[model samples]
Target: MQRVVSNLCNLLCSHYEITLISCYKANETLPATYNFPTNVKIIYFNEIYPDFKLDSFWDKVKFSYRINQLLPNGSKNILIVNNLLYPFFKKKNTIYIRLFHNSFENAYKKYLYKKPLFPPRIALFDKLIVLSSKELNHWQKLHKNIEVIPNFLPSIPKESSPLQSKIVLSVGRMDKGDQKGFFRLVDIWEIVQKDSRFGEWKLHIVGDGLLKEQIEEKIKAKNLQDSIILKPFTNQIEQEYLQASIYAMTSLFEGLPMVLVESASFGLPQISFDINTGPSDIIENEKSGFLIPDGDLEGYAEKLKALMQNQNLRESMGKRAKEIAQEKFSKEAILLKWQKMFNN
Candidate 1:
């Protein structure tokens, strides 16, 4: 969503002087040449040195002071916050929009306060932007200004080559084994490999993880390296989607992944383990993609193998996936929604 937000802000700047602020320290770095347009000014909030991990009252006091110091200098600035440094620094003219990526009521009630990184001031924004109707409804009961604007997709590439292989791809950080269902996917793959139903179709795992070495060990022990390809993370993810015929997701949960939107942009039909809150909103079951019951290992394999055996089914669903993404999640569509909200 960073790229989408950046691009949308740039588009908005044709009519307004927009400054993009980054509050969190980079979890990882991007190449410097990955540039935004020249008109856009990028500023990180670390100049005031907010204490990232507050272990004591002193740290919280210092952090609050630092945030007050770092609050932008203009009275009229539209402070679009991703649920950080909110309610701490109030400006009468500042239009604070809470971009709630996750932490819907279920997630908030279950995990927010327990996690060190959960934003404590989530309730103080002028308005909240969520991804789904379910989340908007959940927040609207407590807060009045909640809106649902789903994640945006970039324009589709002009040319898409025909699928050359029966490759099923799963993309995510492999670090949280259960979160992305990497371990469960591997276990299901193990069962599918031994069965005659899968034949020579391959499962390609993309993206890096903390469990890389352990996952490699498991693959080696199973003697399935020949049938499975494990790739490190890459910015050039479109290449994988272009080459593969299907996108497979086994996420136990999500905040509506941009990858699913991007996969649909590539016209790749998906086979996902439908857990709470994301896939059903995006997939539309067998129409655009196939969704298995939450964590149903047998169902995951059965559906994956079924799609693998039928090339016609893959093409039919993939076309539908692309169409849905183009209509609902395109960048222009989302920006128009934002434009109306900001102007109103």
Candidate 2:
């Protein structure tokens, strides 16, 4: 979300008077991880509520108060907030557009025990902006006004991978055991390795999280210490794509997975579970990549093995990936959509 905000503001700052309100301190010692244009103003509200936790509604109220103080009246301002909605979000004349970061069905599927609220809390905003059309259709069933504006690629590479390396790339934080599906990816890699032909291949996962130690233990248990490597989150993620021949993701769901789009920019053939929202939007099923059925472990391995064995097939699919990235996920294309939204 930080990357998204930074990139969006960088693009908008060229045309709009942009102010970036953040939750963390932005001082000499602690600055933003991503660079912001000089025109974009920065605000750090963390000090206002020194010790914060999501234990109660009053805690959310304090958080909202900080937000309100930064841009109290929304009369001429368009408040694009993803942080949290209200204990106090009602601002007169403000065009509130809440960014729903996850697929509509993603959280519900993960937490089946918790029934979803009718209409969902996103209805609190004047407009709800989602990343994919899949989720757009889902919420349209409720007759809520929504927009499908996918993520824009942060940068497009001048050179794509040659598809000659024996490495597979997967990038995302392992927030929990399942959200990004690194656990299932480990399970999938184990199956892919059953064929001795894949002996020299490597799986490079780049990201760090609360579950990092547990994922490390799982790799050791499988004796995949050498074959499967876990890399820390990187600022230069393009380097990972350049070093690999293919990309794969086992995510159960997504609101347009940026990694998949990033892979497309590097012209890497991808293999991913056809979850509720993301993969189908970017991949042309067998053209740019393969979209395996959810939980079809064997099917995923079979398709990945096919790509690993044939260089021609990987190159063909990768070429299509680059084309798709340019035509659909370009920054200029998405910025126009946002411009229209902001104008009227």
Candidate 3:
């Protein structure tokens, strides 16, 4: 929502009154501050509690009730619901557009290990928007109104440095609490650190996670303390992309990661394990990036080495990546597609 909504505001700032409504109030300032016009109104609907986790029954009930009652009932309100909130209320002539950020079946299987709670609500959605072509295919097997609308990152800053560091970076929620693919990333990183060839290169992880302690333990056990640097989250991730040469991910799955888009915008080619559908769509193997065969740690390590050893290949691919990003994924270009959706 950040990419599309923010870009939408940018595109129609002068013509439309874009109000950004947050379900739960945030204590800290909005991340990556908005450049909204004076016409835009940002407001919070539900009270934010510090201890509310979605897994709790009481929290879920309270949230559902609050959401069901609080949505703006104004005739002009276009209730663009994110995937998780689609099952809750009803609105008429509200342009009930649903944005599916992740693959539904994959996420439900990974998180719930059960079927969706509100199957009927899924059927009632007027339209579904997803980031990758693969996700459109996945959903279209059951629904016809699904559309592909890829997310875009703003252009890299003028002062951003060229891809110079040999460091391989992966950005995602490090919380081992979810059990999604945190361990798999740590395992692959350990394998990458064992070779002396990567001695000159660093494995810098930038994100906070519940599994920080466990991730640290694995690094210490492999005596990769010096080789691997676990840094906390930073709002200025563009700098991380600027210094890094390669973006690596071992996610078991995704809905086309924003980090990969951000990384590629600066010509930092990716090396990711084949997930259910996102990485393969973004990373063109041996062209702009390499997609390691799924669950192949040894192959991932070797691919990383090949990119690291040959600086020319890395630079060439990074340059090609920047071209692809500029031509296909800029916010200005992608915003046109969204405008067309709104028009339809």
Best-fitting candidate, scored by lDDT: 2
lDDT of the candidates, in the order given:
0.74, 0.83, 0.71
Candidate 1, 1-344: lDDT as tens digits: 56656656656777777777665547445314444667877766664455465666566556545655545675566667663344555655667777767747545755455864444455566788888776765677557887788877657665452555878888998775457878778888887898866758788999787887778888888887887789989988888889898888988788887788788888888888776677777797998889898868998888888777888888888888888888888877877887788787
Q: Which scores higher on lDDT, 2 or 3?
A: 2
The residue-by-residue lDDT of candidate 3 on 1-344, one tens digit each, is 55566666666666555766676656455535655556777666644444545665566656555554555665555666774465344554566667777765566434333445444555667787877886665577546897788777656444433556778888878764532465666677677767777777888888887888788887788777887888899988877888888888878778877777778777887788877777776788899889888889889888988888887888888877777777767867776787787788
What is the per-residue lDDT of model 2 for residues 251-320, given as tens digits with 9 covering 90 to 100? Answer: 8778888888889899999999998889999999999999999999999999999999999999999999
Count steric clashes of candidate 3: 4
Task: Mark the regions of model 2 whose C-alpha exceeds 4 Å error after superposition.
Answer: 23-32, 45-75, 87-93, 108-121, 141-143
TM-score per prediction, in order, is 0.85, 0.85, 0.81
Which residue pairs does candidate 2 place in steric collision? none
Count steric clashes of candidate 1: 0
Q: How close is each model in CA RMSD to the real structure?
A: 3.5, 3.4, 4.4
153, model 2: CA deviation in Å?
A: 1.6
User: At residue 235, what lDDT does model 2 achieve?
Assistant: 85
